[model samples]
Target: DQQVKQNSPSLSVQEGRISILNCDYTNSMFDYFLWYKKYPAEGPTFLISISSIKDKNEDGRFTVFLNKSAKHLSLHIVPSQPGDSAVYFCAARPGSQGNLIFGKGTKLSVKP
Candidate 1:
């Protein structure tokens, strides 16, 4: 079973603070991890990604870390802004088709 789990269905953060979201996976075959940000009624856009080969990856305000041993991953957003409010999904792929198995999602709300 390729189930990716986001324990927190939602999170709230004050503007300009750091926001952290967590995810876990049950499939050991999953080696590539990705995080996607989505707004209402729109497709998710890729935020950051990490291969099983690496433990951490970062891009400006967003960072993602993967722990292969624990089968867990997390996304961090610093100085969270109101504009950053949206649903975030964690995904994993086995390095072939690039087809993803997604977590239910975590909705982040940044209050101004």
Candidate 2:
């Protein structure tokens, strides 16, 4: 079973537009949600995160929203730039250990 799923394999956006990525999970044990931004040939870097206790978290141009009842989450990047073009991965960890379960990934291409 796919514990985590990223429906879109890729997305394209204009430099100043908003880019939205979606993710869903089936495991109820998950209590923490994280978003990672990855560039070519590099490990994913933590972007933003939300806990099951809260519904939303935001940083600079990035925001993450979680819906516990629906077992769903999303990431939004505003005024996306070329520098933001990369693969975004959604990860979740259960209440105990901090090890993460990851989605396939969504590649975002921001045109200048």
Q: What tens digits encode model 1's per-residue C-alpha lDDT throughout 1-112?
A: 5489999999999999999999999888888999999999999998999998999999999999899889999999998999999999999996667688899999999999
Quote the positional error of residue 20 for candidate 2 in Å: 0.4
What candidate 1 gets wrong by more than 4 Å, as runs, is: none
Candidate 2 residues 16-78, lDDT tens each? 999999999999999999999999999999999998999999899999999888999999999
Candidate 2 has an lDDT of 0.94
Output the lDDT of residue 95, model 2.
74
lDDT (Cα atoms) of all candidates against the true structure = 0.93, 0.94
Tell me, by lDDT, which candidate is best. Answer: 2
- Candidate 1 lDDT at 106 equals 99
> In terms of TM-score, how similar is model 2 to the real structure?
0.96
User: With candidate 1 superimposed using the best TM-score fit, by how many Å does residue 34's alpha carbon deviate from the native?
Assistant: 0.7
lDDT (Cα, 0-100) at 50 in candidate 1: 93
What's the CA RMSD of model 2 in angstroms? 0.9
All candidates: TM-score: 0.94, 0.96
